[model samples]
Target: MNKPTLLFTAALLTAPALLALTACQPSGPVTNAPETNANSVTTLPISELPLHAEQATRLDNNLWLGVHPHGDIQIRDGQGALVGQQPVAAEFISQRRDAQGDFFLSLTTDNQLMFYRASAQGISDLHLSAELPWPLEGMCLYQPSAQELNLFVMDESAIAHQLLLTRTQGELLAREIRQFPLPPLAEYCVVDDSTDQLFVSEENIGVWSYNARAESEVLRKPVDLVKPWGALEHNTGPLAISQGQLLVAELGSDLLHAYPLDGGDTRTWQLAPIAAGQPLAADALTVSADSDKTVMAVLDDNNGKVYRAELTLPARAGDNQRIVQVAPVAETRPMRKSGDAADDPAIWVNQQQPELSRIIGTNKKYGLYVYDLAGNELQELVVGRVNNVDVRQGFSLKGQAADIAAASQRDRKAIALFSIDPLNGQVSTAGEVVTTLDNVYGLCMYRNITDNRFFVFINDQDGRFEQYEITDSSAGWRGKKVREFAVKSQPEGCAADDRQQRLFIGEEDVAVWTLSADAGAPTDMTQVAAVSDVLVADIEGMDIYRSDTEAYLVVSSQGNDSYVLYQAEAPYEYVGRFRVGINAEKGIDGASETDGLTVTSQALGADYPAGMLVVQDGRNLLPDENQNFKTISWDSIRAVVIAP
Candidate 1:
């Protein structure tokens, strides 16, 4: 977050109606629902079948119990009145959902871990996903998404290893299994699901956070998220997360403890204290905090008794823990190159299916990479010497509307073209063409929606800029000379406002300038951001983000390691500036000396449901590892600079 550091004469720009997205809420696996199917395959209604509560979970307005022995599940209202139930073999039953918001059940059998497509009627499509690689003496499944799950499965050898399980079905059933080492004493586990974070309670050690998305070696086990929670060597029971608070059953003592999700100061209460044999053995715990009703249920395993009580977290939560709770969530992985710089990122929004959208980024020394919102690389294009990359859609070529991406190839002194598959979201080479400018350095493309034309701007080391109007020819794509101009100094970052047909260029050593997008039009070499003023020298990346009534031009002020924002309209006015700081919890460093960056206002997925800002980290140090891109949620940006 940042404030305007400079004063200007311009009046306050018009405010925009920042329409909140109503389509999204706390409605994932973390939220509440009235009734849910708890079966992998069709059998019979759980209510009609005779079954007992093996494990109880709180859903929307009711409590769901895993009716085992026959593997059925039942739902009961707040007053302990039976409402609905379903019969299916769901032992370790947990409610999950696919990208479409369709409910599913994360199930575990004697020898298999699986999921079942569920509906109000019943459950079907039993995906017997993964077989027991090693005998799971103990296991915990945290389903944050259909494909993203953190699993702690321990073998009889007393060695615990966390596995990230993934499953996708279509043309073929694709399954992936990656293992992460965990503490040997790790026992019970609980998931926030909203974030891919898990809380594991060690029998001897304190509770720890298990994040498989750590920014280390691809499949390496992540270190502690915040810090090891609770007193060391304390025996703790199960865990339940509700309203940013973690409820714990203290097995070592006759008490229940609650702590802020960040493992800050905690509060405890006695539960069956000083009883006869075992003073209230709390071996299992479940709390319904995602719904209107607040209740907690715990199992006294040694006493063979289950108790339900009202649950309320202390109102005294420290501001520090609150800050950690609101910090953005991210997933960082290694780039293709172990020592290369992570430069530039482009966000592609798949309207039909948001989950399929890809984040295209350049692995400077390796090639271009395509990744999902989870930061998992889906594809990599080994094009050589690629510097800056830009993408556009709805370009009709060969009688078909195509999505084209272009990158500046420094090795060949040319611009390389690639086509993207809309369905599968893959990148393939279209053609290669040389640039008109010599020693091409910076590159960006603009597509005019009104005229259905593509214009690419390329600049060189000598301050010469070339704007080319691209069109598909009978043989291949060709560029026609539009207009050539020279700035006062060398330039790099460049972007165009397609709706306004205005081109803004960044002269690295001078400042930002704007001109007309039309060829042969009058040039406006006006300095929008001067060096040493609102902006610093060596501006590296520039991109435009638009809301309903406002647009912002963001430029990387590499000198200060921050980004300056401005109103994208004519007579461009300054907005504010912000620097992406380090995230020690996820083991990620912020952007510094950013080469290129991209932003999208389109809600990509849960991670970026309100949109996101991705920047290139030129100096990814701290732990001394290869550079990697860092993604920040637009909500975090809007809270400071963009919000009214």
Candidate 2:
């Protein structure tokens, strides 16, 4: 296949004009002045925030929280008022504050450490601390001695999947001071100075603690926090130490559990529900002491709002603590085609009737195939390259009131809309080619239910997106030019959350982008979560799945043979990453690569049925070697979740 030359030609022809347009715009209008006062009690309406909030910590009296929605760190007072916000830098995905009142942020993007000291003047203290040898996820301040301000960071070293504790005391830095390798899929970790303990939370398997000063010590035996609760749900959340007791935030039940370190007593408190209509997906939390009151800072992920609640610890009796759902503000599916060999998938579903899904997938050397939800390969369409496909239903022209419905069905029957022989996988061109798409790697389908029209979005490797509208069709299907948008990097895989009017685009080395629908452009983009060092090669496919208020964005790492799953935090939250283990049959151990990924509710029905993740195994083919695709069921995935 020829590398898309048409897109390069279009860029060459339009570069100068675009440069001139950019040059004409003013750039000095923005300044670094503090936008809001430290005590400013500004309340960001819920509509402007993220969908879920994860990872909440107390930075002295002022609480700092991280949200997955937009990957922003928000600062609030003890009274729970939005004081300031800062978009996390590209290098970091997680952050924690130290005892010296310095925010220790984990720069997972670049495998470095950042220190942001928040003063009364807001985020005026930002410093680039020491860089780590490997990427890290969880971080906390380890104050072993009062005179030293040492930071402990957790590194995801694949060798043993251990947490490399890097201690830094000014110029004296020790890399890999201590290593704690736990079972795979470890959730949250915290260094408790009060008890001199390090608590690590594992999924299904409860909490484990070890001496902070020990080099390689076994945890204080294991505690099975979750019992055999059948196949309904799983437990995952953050762990912290409060008043010599270990506090575990159960995300599955939205409950904060308090277990005594001395094995004295156990108490569970239900967090207050957020305000009416507000979604509550708590990621991480921290409890703060205020002379007379015990306050807790919770990341309200639903709307990307941070909330502070008053905590009343039990004095002597077995009474439970009360938690009130406080107010927080926050931010912020498929189709296919036909081909015997489904290469790429493009989905089209009516906005009003999303259940009526239509998919267009490529057959590579053969042609395209159309399919319904029932796995019935309907028809096949043909096109050049046929590397990717996109479908749009009920498209309208600027001046045409044509019968598109009758035309769509008729075209399917005549095999004239595009061209494909379902039996033999051959292309018979009937429709004329529109604008040539350059290195088209990703595709999306957008349908306007109000107007009953649709637009097809194609991501070209030349850093541009082409949009085409299905036009008036009497003989078959005809496409018309709609619009085009510029991107910074080559787009790999993309998924659109039409219900939320947002599009998630995965680029090469860059972090994902969340674009708005009204402007048909990106409003905010941040580099938060990435797939280890493998992302440097490229990110391939992405899919968006939403269940009521919760949303998930799964991205495929074409270079690493893994998949990175992100939970939409207050605007979105970066749930921890889950890597699919390659099996012997898949030949992942060989030089084979894992490419495209599609997640649906289909797998939730069999054993897992909560939801299923389907990955494409790209096996290496020698000059005479041939291989077929292998599927990993959700049951196998759940094993990875529990596999140490």
Pick the lDDT winner.
1
Give lDDT tens digits, candidate 1, residues 93-143. 444456654334344555566555443343455565555657654555555
TM-score for all models, in order of appearance: 0.50, 0.37
* Model 2: per-residue Cα lDDT over 284-396, one tens digit each: 56665555445665665454455565555544323121110101010001123222233445443434333334444554445555554333556655443454444333333
Span of 10 residues, lowest total lDDT, candidate 1: 1-10
Model 2: how far is 278 from its true place, Å? 77
lDDT of each: 0.61, 0.45
RMSD from true fold, candidate 2 = 23.7
Candidate 2, residue 21: Cα displacement in angstroms equals 50
lDDT of 1: 0.61
